[model samples]
Target chain A: MSKVMVVTSGKGGVGKTTSCASLGAALAQAGRNVVVVDFDVGLRNLDLVMGAERRVVFDLVNVVQGDAKLPQALIRDKRIDTLSLLPASQTRDKDALTEEGVGRVIDELREKFDWIVCDSPAGIDKGATLAMRFADLAVVVANPEVSSVRDSDRIIGLLDSKTRRAESGEAMEKHLLLTRLDAARAARGEMMKVEDVLEVLAIPLLGTVAESPDVLTASNLGCPITLHSPTSPAARAYTAAARKLLGETVTVTPAREKRGFMSLLFGKKAVLQ
Target chain B: MSILNFFSRNRSAPVARERLQLLLAHERTLAGKSDLVALLQREVLGVIARHIAIDPDKVIVKLDETGHVSTLEIDIEVPEGALARG
Candidate 1:
């Protein structure tokens, strides 16, 4: 059966766009037909991140509104044969996305692709709720912080009520993607610790991404980190996260210096002399 | 609370969790205490008016984030004889 996973968070700038690009690329690299759908309408950032911005002629709204056919809206990646992108409309109002319209497109995608991944916009507004509506699974993107965790908790509540499985009162398969993690700062008591976020969210941890400028470099160049800097720590974490999504028994590498909560406090590496 | 406190408390160990703590809440409040100031104003005035008629416009509840610790201030301009009745 095909899986439709929505990459969502109650907050933005948490690397949902980055994760969508990397996981889509990873699955395609593994030879599965995967299409990453950008549901962040008007902003429409996924295309630029995927390096397909200049190539988009039609978008999800076009397919839904019948302005263009599905194939016309789909853009294949030049680097990866198996990965594709269903870009969002830059000019279309977010209101253009109707429940029935999105349902039609999602149904079409599920039949043709092994995985249909939706990248949800931030907040608990209509945009976010719609993105997760058809999702069989959800990747809740959260930064290791209190506000993001609280927002994620709100989203978890929404997921339990706003989704197809949720309407039927079935549990929505959800996982947490903690990004921008800085081990050094975390050691110095400057950031939220991973275990803390996990406890509050209460969802299974998919993986953790260490803070890396490589993510910025890739997004700037319109490439997924997995494709832009595949060897970086962040990209490797994403790959591992993807494997975990596939139900593979994998061990997530713990961040350095995070051996114990109190032990991390004094290990601060004062800048190199 | 600070980002460090956010992580420390959540991890059940006082580890620094600054990235998410500072960044996320900063994003949520969008402008920090400036936003909370508005929310606190409504609640504080509503509660205080039970005994006195203080000008709601002049009442200010704010978080002073200077110093190593964060402090909250509720400055009220009670209409001269407003507090005399209490």
Candidate 2:
């Protein structure tokens, strides 16, 4: 059965798009059929991040407006054959996306793919709510910061209350994807430690993506770090996160501290090294 | 500067408390001292109100943030004669 996973964080710039692209590609690379859908509307960026902007002749809005068929709007990755993208329209307003319209698209996607990864826009708005309405699981992407963790807490509360499964009193599998962790910084007590964030959020850890230029380098190339810079630390982090999401057990290493004992106490996150 | 920089917008700052302060501010403007003091006072008053009849206007709440060593100081003025019997 297909699983709908919404990558959301009420706070912005927490690498939601990057995680979506990387996780989707990683899962597809693992031979699973995955479709990453951009739900950001107006600001549609997943295509830009995925390096498929120019190839997008139609998008989610086009499909919803009945201007194009689903398959017509679906763009198969030229590089990763198993992965595909359902881009969002840069012209349509967020209001143009209806609950029923999105539901239909997700249902169709569910019938065809193993995973439908939705890249949600930031904040607790209609777009964000709808993007997560049908998610069977969620990746609450958060940066190792107090504000991000707090906002993620709000998003997590919504995931447990606003989702269909939640509405029906069913538990939705949720995971935490803590990104942009700087070991030296975290160790120095400069950044919110993973343990602190985990204690506050109280969710199972998936994997941690360090703050690294390889992420920017891959973004410039419009590819996932896993694809553009597979050997980089950030890429390995995303790959491990992807593996964990697929029900595999993987231990996440703690980032070293530059000024503190994050590394000494928790140990360097073995996978990052 | 390491101690003072905590809670700044600068990403180079070192101190989890500073990061926490900066992050809390990002989510809401009311996280500042004055705003938080007022909020804390209101909550404290409500809690005290449930237990006894007292004048809330005399309630005092102080949050001292000195180099990340924060301590909450609160004083709730009991209605003039309420404490006399106790």
Candidate 3:
């Protein structure tokens, strides 16, 4: 059976798109059929993250509006055979995602893919709600900041109240993917520790992606970090997170601090913005 | 001393954590107040009111989340001796 997982954060710039791409790529590399759907509408970033931007001819809006078929709009990842991308329309508004249309598309996708990872837009709006309406589980992407944690808490409440599973009296499994963690800063009390965030949000920890220049470099190179720099701390953390998502018994830990020698060599601080 | 401890004394993280806890509790209570209030009133408060002379409308249900456990408080006012009779 296909599992629909929504990678969402109520706040923007918290790495929701990055998590979707990395997890989707990681799962595909592990031989799972995964499709990462971009629901950011006007500001589509998942395609850019997955390096499938140039190949996107028809997008989610086109498929939903009946202008194109599902297979025609799906972009198969060139590097990962089992991975695909359903890019959102940069030209269309969030209103283009109709409830019935999204339902039909998700139902059709459930038949063909083992995982449907929906990348939701920021804030609790039609786009975000529509992205999460049919989810079987949620990966709430959060940063180690107050605003991000608070916003993710709001998203968690929505996952409990606004989802189809919630309405149908089914439990919506939610895990917190804490991103942009700076271990040195966290140790210095400059950033909220993973335990503090888990306490505040009260959600199960998925994985922690440390503050790393590898993320920026990978984004600039238009590849998932796990594929671009497989040995990097961020990549390893994401892979572990993917394993945990598959019910593997992997011990969860905060991302390692790699700022001293690595920063001196790279000459750029891997700080969260 | 390790240079990593340079910012150890900064108070921003604790401040942010405190504010986030307060805000999350307030937000959760606000979102769940109505439905939870109705349900509790119909089931719990009704039974309590039967044994005591109490005001159902004034019952307060505040959800305070500390760490992983959320504490729910139901404050209902009852006249003196109302509980003593039952």
Q: What's the TM-score of every candidate structure?
A: 0.74, 0.74, 0.80
For residues A142-205, write the lDDT of model 2, one tens digit per residue. 9977678878877887898788999999998899988888766554445666766776677888
lDDT of 3 by residue, A1-273 (tens): 899999999999999998899999998888899999999999999999888889999999999999999999999999989999999999989999899999999999999999999999998999999999999999999999988888898899999999999999999999989888877666556788888898898888888888789999999998999899999989998999999888899887558775565335433332331
Q: Pick the candidate with the highest DockQ.
A: 3
Q: Give lDDT tens digits, candidate 2, residues B1-86.
A: 34444435343323554555555444333232566798889988998888778777889888666565768899876766776766
Worst 10 residues of 1 chain B by lDDT: B10-19
Clashes found in each candidate (C-alpha, N, C closer than 3 A): 9, 11, 0
| Ranking of all predicted structures according to TM-score, beginning with the best and ending with the worst | 3, 2, 1
Cα lDDT for residue B35, candidate 2: 69
C-alpha lDDT of residue A259 in model 2 = 35
Q: Write the per-residue lDDT of candidate 1 for residues A1-273, one digit (tens) a residue.
A: 899999998888888888899888877876789999999888889998999999999999999898899999999999998899999999977899999999999999988999999999988777898899999999998887766776887788778778998899888999988888876666454565677677556788888887777889989999888888888887888888888888788788754433444444544541210
Using Cα atoms, each model's DockQ against the true complex is 0.08, 0.09, 0.34
Task: Name the docking class for model 3.
Answer: acceptable
Residue A251, candidate 2: C-alpha displacement in angstroms: 2.7
Which TM-score value belongs to model 1? Answer: 0.74
- What is candidate 3's lDDT per residue for B1-86, written digit by digit as tens? 34453434564777788888877777886786667757866677777866677777767776566667877788887777877877
Error of 3 at B4 (Å): 14
1 or 3: which has the higher TM-score?
3
RMSD of 3: 8.0
